[model samples]
Target: MAELNINGNRRMLIGKVVSDKADKTIVVLVETLVKHPLYKKYIRRRTKFMAHDPANDCKIGDKVQIVEFRPLSRRKRWHLDKILEKAV
Candidate 1:
């Protein structure tokens, strides 16, 4: 049913898979640049996201895209959308 699906924009992120030790799940590290309000210098900030990887296809250092999803576990709130690139 239409009601079963989310109807609004969802947060999507692109990051590199850092860990895949947990079955069907992955830890992705996303990095972003932010400019300091005062110093006006760009700084790198990184965040770790727990994402569902139903296929267990991701590997460390692989770039992937993920979409926000309803919480599947205590901390997993994102699901793998696609693998952008494989780690060499």
Candidate 2:
């Protein structure tokens, strides 16, 4: 829900960096609250996204912003926009 706009209509998402072991790639975990159809209760849903990190400046637990972009690999469709906060 903290999405931002940059470079036109591409989608943007905010998430936490869960993995940064890959050479120039980072795995971001985006979580959202979804309401159940019948239960009317909110459920935490998580999605992992492979994002391109050209500078490899991210680390695990870092909050980062990512924007949708052309696929760089079979699974990489997002690029690092900026780091929101650094992990302590």
Candidate 3:
């Protein structure tokens, strides 16, 4: 898990915004590498998270930091904390 705990146990993650077409919402893609138990090979894993972007300040390909928060919708459990890098 690439979750960073800070500010009293809140989980934060750094990811890239893959989709920002939804109103007040953005889809972030997080990648992680895991070692295989038997082969001892690193495997890439990707996860998509639906984060709440109330300001709609994110765009596709933008690097962002999202923090875990109380569920505001059926699929939204993360809130947009900040933009780490904007897509050029």
Q: Mind giving the per-residue lDDT tens digits that candidate 3 earns over 25-61?
A: 9999998888999999999899999999999999999
**lDDT of each structure?**
0.87, 0.91, 0.91
Q: How many residue pairs clash in each candidate?
A: 0, 0, 0
lDDT of 3: 0.91
Better of 1 and 2 by TM-score: 2
Writing each residue's lDDT as its tens digit, candidate 1 over 2-35 gives 0112437787788999899999999999888889
**TM-scores for every predicted model:** 0.90, 0.91, 0.92
Off by over 4 Å in 3: 1-3
| Root-mean-square deviation (CA) per prediction | 6.5, 1.9, 1.8
Candidate 2 lDDT, 25-83, residue by residue in tens: 99999988889999999998889999999999999999999999898999999999899
Error of 3 at 34 (Å): 0.7
